[model samples]
Target: MNLDREVIKALAPTGVLRASINLGNPILANTSKSTGEPEGVSIDLARAFAQHLGVDVELVVFDAAGRSVQAVASEQADIGFFAIDPVRGAEIAFSAAYVLIEGSYLVREESPLLHNDEVDRDGCLVAVGKGSAYDLFLTRELKHAHIVRAPTSPTVVQTFLEQELDVAAGVKQQLESDCRKHAGLRLLPGRFMVIRQAMGVPKTRGAGAARALHAFVEEMKDSGSVADALQRHSIEGASVAPNEA
Candidate 1:
């Protein structure tokens, strides 16, 4: 469990651990309703990781997943929590997932779409957060459905309603909350995809740094820190990822 000096230096070159926090993913990170400051599972993990490195933590916040990914890939951030995708893998070294979330589809209750499969029809239009994991996954999997991109995951439902799109795609928890807030909206029977949420470091950080961060994440998962964060944050519709070891 020794923290390597070189790894720490690489991870926090500025003597501060800059964590790329995406507030768009409410289950993982979000603005505190009362304080207006950032707080959530990701923030908890960022603080923990920073403490392990004996460095101060700095949050580089973003409103969308794409911008978060960009921050880490471009070395603007030391580490970040991200949904694993091969597209993002090129510029980032990803640890085994510490959590998993469901990517779901939402439609008007009166809409004819009853199942996840039914949303891929030729005339179907799906509203998705631009550069989100759901957007990336669906872009590859769906052939006939046209994707209408929204500015962020939180806006997907609003965009869908305004544009009169056929379906909205996002995290199951987010969709569920939206369904309750707006009413007359329903989630499909099952999930469209399972998002593997993991810790990531810029690949340019070197193999030693990547391995160190990966081991840290694995230890956090095995130690139940990830589960505790989810519970502490009252995050539902998501689960801790299984320990890889």
Candidate 2:
């Protein structure tokens, strides 16, 4: 496929395509047990995008979603995989979502909370990853319940358990994996939100770069590349998003 030089230059201004990879979201990315390299759907997509541009891909890894977003927003990285949110949109130009992941709350089995709504009442303390999609959304939407921020999305459960917080909020799969390890932790029935996972570049990258990324996202989704990547990584509890509506 012929590529646009200006778009490629805008996206890979430093001579190589630098993609921010967040390992906090297990369904999107994780460390390879053997090679210790980042691997997951997001990494796969990033490599594919850089390959399409005829550029070598470099993974700028972060253990938290906020750090990853900040990397892209600060122009430290060329692109990033992120959950699309209004708060992050100020500095990031996000493509239409290529995948959808469920955001859920986890509570101790003995806890009284059974529904997502019940966690919002007074005296309830929810643990969330600092600057995560759940934290940003809850900060804007929640009126009563208090929020306790963990250092990263992957540590929400540990924070919740250690602090005895009322609930843990994060990716459903992460919570599920934590529940299996810790026991006595149960996810609230259903999901509180559908996270729109997408590729993004700094808004300063220009409209051409943004449109190119957006079109690439739509193509990845429509062509089943995103779905195939999920399957190849054995990722469950997430689905490829439909074309931008």
Candidate 3:
């Protein structure tokens, strides 16, 4: 059967949502190195959601995760796809999480930090994305480490590449993706935090909109569509958790 027309119409005019881009993982960004267009997991998921509603998609790109959420809060876009944190949930309505993630640190393979818990010892420079969950975790847990906040994940990666920091922390997927792209970078074993990634809708959009979108996501999960999408995109370490709604 055809999906709801109203939902499709709501998305049709511009057919795009503003998304945060990570240059480290071109696959997750849905980027075509040749065409300069989005092509990865987020793009596929967002496009499928739009297509189910019978609409095309337009992808607006933002360089930082913080700005991605801000785009939705500012009504610069309809929704955002990223990791959902309790703090961000308080500011924006979140759909049921479609992916599970863990936090980890990326460091040079030869760095002493790779072998010691003392990596977080006093005066060690750790790079993290500003306003990101990793930054939040560092503030609370890595008290001895001198945290250096980068505005974006790519920048954090760049800083670490430049040997300017002892560690760069972020989602495990992102860290692994970086490791594959850059030699001599390795991810630490233990996770700092477990995360669930979801779509974010603006708070000002009202409860009904949030409910509708949440229901749509729930339906996708229940029907195994979300799992299929994850597999289709070859996303590793992602699974849909049980949803109350």
- Top candidate by lDDT: 1
The superposed Cα distance between candidate 2 and the true structure at residue 139, in angstroms, equals 0.6
- Residue pairs with colliding backbones in model 1 are none
Q: In candidate 1, what are the lDDT values of residues 1-245, reduced to their tens digit?
A: 68779889999999999999999999999888999999999999999999889999999999999999999999999999999999999999998899999999999989988989898999899999999999999999999999999999999999999999999999999999999999799999889899999989999999988888888899898889999999999999889998775
Task: Please identify model 2 stretches exceeding 4 Å from their true place.
Answer: none
Candidate 3 collision pairs: 15-58, 16-58, 30-38, 30-39, 30-40, 31-39
Candidate 3 lDDT over residue span 1-245, tens digit each: 24354544343335554334433333356457788776666676677666665555567677677777777777777777767777777778888876677778888878776543666798888888887767766787776889888868667787766766888888678788789988888887787677677777777766655666677777778888777777786778756767857
Give the CA lDDT, 0 to 100, for residue 109 in model 3: 77
TM-score of every prediction relative to native: 0.98, 0.98, 0.81
lDDT of 2 by residue, 1-245 (tens): 46689889999998899999999999999999999889999999999999889999999999999999999999999999999999999999999999899999999999988899898898889999999999999999789999999999999999999998999999999999999999788999999999999999999989999999998888888888999999999999898888884
- What is the model-wide C-alpha lDDT for candidate 1? 0.93
Cα lDDT for residue 195, candidate 3: 69
lDDT, model 1, position 109:
86
| Model 1's TM-score against the true structure | 0.98
Give the candidates in order of lDDT, highest first.
1, 2, 3
